[model samples]
Target: MDMFRRTFAEVNLDHVAHNFEVLKAAFPNTSFLCPMVKANAYGHGDVAIALCLQQAGARHLGVCLIEEALLLRRGGVTANILVFRGFDREGAEQLLANNLTPVVSTWDQLEALEEMAKTPVKIHLKFNTGMNRLGFSIEEAEKLFDKCWRHPKIQVEGVLTHLFNGEDADELDGDSADQLGKLLRILLVFKPLNPLNHSLNSAGILNALIVREQKNPQHILNQVQWGLRPGLMVYGFNPLKRQDILPLKPVMTLKSVASTYRMLKVGEVVSYGGTWKAKRDSVVAIVPIGYADGYHRILSNKAEVLFNGYKVPVVGTICMDFLMVDVTDAIHGCDLNDLRDKEIILFGKSDQGQFISAEELAHRAQTITWEILTSVGERVPRVYVGDWAKRLGVAN
Candidate 1:
């Protein structure tokens, strides 16, 4: 870790706690939260984030694959883990061994598990309400219910579906609502089992996690279970791309130090491809971070870094290990003397009042905040902050 130099990701776990509270507070107490910790908690480090969220009252955690679940279990996470990507036979056996829930999305998956099981296993049934990405068709769920109605080793404990377009639609108008309707019908069929149900993702939670089912008002299944599984929102991002009413705190701040400075004359180019030419004499700072570190090449000359509370624009094509930022205007009094090792804020708050959020970097990279966060590479060692760091014996 000592060889890491100054470039690394600084994670503020307090923000995660704050974001969790904000998301959970939005819904009723009857609701449950399983903040998605897949993709390394969207690149914020899954094990750490998962543990913090669990401590904050998350009953279960959602991951996309079996490896992710295994990683969590290995990390000593004892809470219920839900694997969204329904597994194959081998994967199902492993999931069962780990006590993780595999969402049965396909009928083949159901039959395979039923055939392979030696003993009973709890499962969550997933229906392809509309996403069509995964899950069983409603007909499949109904038929499966009949088959599993009394089958051993295949207890359907929960029902779930994904909302493909939760961001654009309101409560009762769009595809999300329709998907909810489809899921509701299937749930009604499974009402006798009284399985826990879920359908909301981050966007759905923001707009509508719990909506009253208009028809069949008397049935218990008429209500949508607030099993809102928020992913990006837990990391303080508004997936809808509007004003973040939740105002979630950004948990990770990508940063590095200015290792060296460059003096370029007028008309001189910088970095590879000679993409940026100096209009006048310019001073540049070479930061030890680049596309290889998850700072996309698309940010070549468009990205900005914070220098002592000022914005320094990046110059030329970003290399595998480094990128140069024009510090000409920023190289006032003190920095002119020596630019070596001066703190450069890539995207996050600095001790000197300079601040940049993931949203800014995502914009320049022409990607979403989720990608910006999750794409941070492995080499950039993460420095844990907030109370989590203290409890984990890692805070600096």
Candidate 2:
């Protein structure tokens, strides 16, 4: 079935590939570029996005769970895939059967592997530097290193940790730098193991590298083979908030159209709870999308859309599958005689060359970049476009 509809997401793989190339070039010493395709590649459709990154020269792909890995495998993605969330005994057996790497984070996972390992399993050890959510502590990791030191079935192929605030601006010995320093101290213990050294995510890649430079100005980032896993940036949002950092392009374009228009008299209420009333004789366009599509309800009166380059305010509480945009100021530029189907720019580049950015929408929603991207509801049909293969110099 064709999923394209009046409201949909356009995922430009060309933009994705470009971002991947830029990120890979930044870390030449990187053994491989592992673009995290978890959370459905941040709601851009994981299998399609992952395939694009692979063709764009990703050395490996990262996912959150075994189910995600299996989806890619079944979708014909044969690249080296790693499941970041460690699995149970059955999940570990499936991981082995599927030949996907598991991120062994906890002692329970290690014991599960021990009980289930019929063959040698190459695992990446996860250390909880400060996130304190997943993975073993530093002392527990020391014991884990010894446990896997020469295990018959467990092969510690790499070590990694998450940088909680790697994108924050404060540079001097802050949480991000301090946490990375702690991880490095532990990573040093496994230097002799020669695993694929990797710890930087999208936010961490540029900022953490800066931290490394500041902390060790004399020498390059150690002898271990470092790699990077660009997640959000891979989908084309700069966590550092500097567009020049990699000149990333916008990948996902959430869109819909003004299905119909209505005239609201002064004092007329709109949507639920009477939260909004037209103070003036206003023209409102029914935008056929709402919180159900991951457009936060908090963005009810706070958000705006693009119409003929004019900012049209969303004036009412967003409904489950519809909302209203006040286009009184912009209606003159559109076909006023036939106001319906005037074209609504939910978020992305507009015909007028202006962009209704996700960051702006996110700000209105009281959230961040990741939430905005990942929360783009699954019902919004994802249409992957662009010539990534040609751009990557690969045969189509």
Using lDDT as the measure, the top candidate is 1
Off by over 4 Å in 1: 209-223, 335-338
Report the poorest 10 consecutive residues by lDDT, candidate 1: 212-221
Candidate 1, 169-269: lDDT as tens digits: 35455787678778878878998888887877778776652333235444232355557788988987777654545777778888888888888999999
Q: Compute the lDDT for candidate 1.
A: 0.81
Error of 1 at 262 (Å): 0.6
Model 1 clashing residue pairs (backbone): none
RMSD of 1: 3.1
How does each model score on TM-score? 0.93, 0.92
Report, for all candidates in order, the number of backbone clashes. Answer: 0, 0
Give the Å error, residue 41, model 2. Answer: 0.7
TM accuracy, model 1 = 0.93
Candidate 2, 32: how far from true, in Å? Answer: 4.0
Show where candidate 2 strays beyond 4 Å.
1-5, 168-172, 208-226, 241-243, 337-339, 389-396
